[model samples]
Target: MILTTHILSGAALGANIPNPYAVAGLSIVLHFLQDTLPHGDYLNKKSRLREFWKVAVDLAIGLSLVTAIVFYKNWLSDEVFLTNISTGIFFSLFPDFTTFLYRYLNMKFLRPIKDFHEGLHCYENGSRRREFRIENGFWDIFITLASLLFLLFLCAG
Candidate 1:
């Protein structure tokens, strides 16, 4: 799934859950659960710069939306809200961050974590190449839309 979808989902969890520890744990669980769905990823991209730019833009947009939502909900003054939401967002992205470190930085110590994360991915024909194709990423697009709608519902509720 795109990082934005993950962020939105995590933000939803944050907005609802009162406990930061619960938010963190559930966000990480949700991140892995979402990854178990068929989705696109930049893992196999050839150009590091291009992949970085894509992730940077995705993160920027996701964070912006989350900030807007937090502001709209008037949670800025609430320390607990900030902590919970930040924990949700951090844990949701933690898996991908570790994977990036293992892949790009050649962090050998994270090999076990990287392997475990890859093992959970739902790939077609055991091929990572298909993950970059637009046609194969319909689920990602759909989930992204669904997440946005969910957030809208939360805001209105």
Candidate 2:
């Protein structure tokens, strides 16, 4: 997601103020990372609420920066790519659609592959990075390549 946001951050350098792609990418990265990072399940209501608000505020600021850029720079001018409402909507929707598809594929296909591999691996000592066989590496690489191809196809259309 940082990678995706990095692409849009380039927009700011392109004489635009806030970039929708950057905003969405940053929001998704922060939200997903915060949600996934292991933290104590036990927390007071105030602490949990504060944590939630902190992430929320970060997201809002990113989105606001995007809006500020668009309006302040008159990014809808012919010089900007997103010059229409539809284009604006498309930029806003792009990351969410990609994320949904990625998550769907991970749940449907990747999880099964990981589960099968997990069944074969055992650790006498606690260690997370286990080098699997060449076949496993190929499977992982194939999935990523296929995903990239799919994205390219989507962009082409």
Candidate 3:
């Protein structure tokens, strides 16, 4: 799943769940759950620079989309709202961020977590084994739209 979808889903979970600890724990779980689903990732292991640029662009757009949604829903005005949503977003992206660090910095302590994350990925074998096609961007839009709609429902409720 795209980071944007994770962020939105985490935010929705946070909004619905009042307990901070539960939100944090469930956000991380949701991150892994989403990754286990068929999704498209644009990262390429052969080209470091190209992969970096692609990931940078994806993160930028994802953050922008989250910010827009927060502002649109008037979530910025409430302190509790800010805390929960930010916490959710942080935990949701924490796995991916740590995996990136482990890959580049070769952190021994993070190796376990990285290995666990890779183990849960649906595309672990490669895109050929992936049920979804990256070329068409179908899963990307499908997941994003579904997440956005769910977020809206959570916010409205």
**Number of the predicted model whose lDDT against the real structure is largest:** 1
Better of 2 and 3 by TM-score: 3
TM-score of each: 0.84, 0.28, 0.84
Model 3, stretches more than 4 Å misplaced? 44-50, 130-139
Candidate closer to the true structure by lDDT (higher is better), 1 or 3: 1
Cα RMSD of predicted structure 3: 2.5
Candidate 1 Cα deviation (angstroms), residue 55 = 0.9
Rank order by TM-score, top first? 1, 3, 2
Per-candidate Cα lDDT values, in order, are 0.77, 0.36, 0.74
Residues 14-110, model 1: lDDT tens digits: 7678888889999999988888877767645254645588888889999998888777767788887778778878889998889888878879899
Number of the top-ranking candidate, with TM-score as the measure: 1
TM-score of 1: 0.84
Candidate 1 lDDT trough over 10 residues, lowest sum: 42-51
Pairs in steric clash, model 3: none
lDDT score for candidate 3 against the true structure: 0.74
**Least lDDT summed over 10 consecutive residues: which range in candidate 2?**
37-46
The sequence of per-residue lDDT tens digits that candidate 3 reaches over residues 38-133 is: 666665333364458767776787778778888788777777877887788888888988877877766879989988888887666355654335
Estimate candidate 1's alpha-carbon lDDT, on a 0 to 1 scale: 0.77
lDDT of 2 by residue, 1-157 (tens): 2222322232322222245555445443433332232222111212333454543553455455555545654555644444332233334334434433334444454545334322343321123232323432443344324433432333221
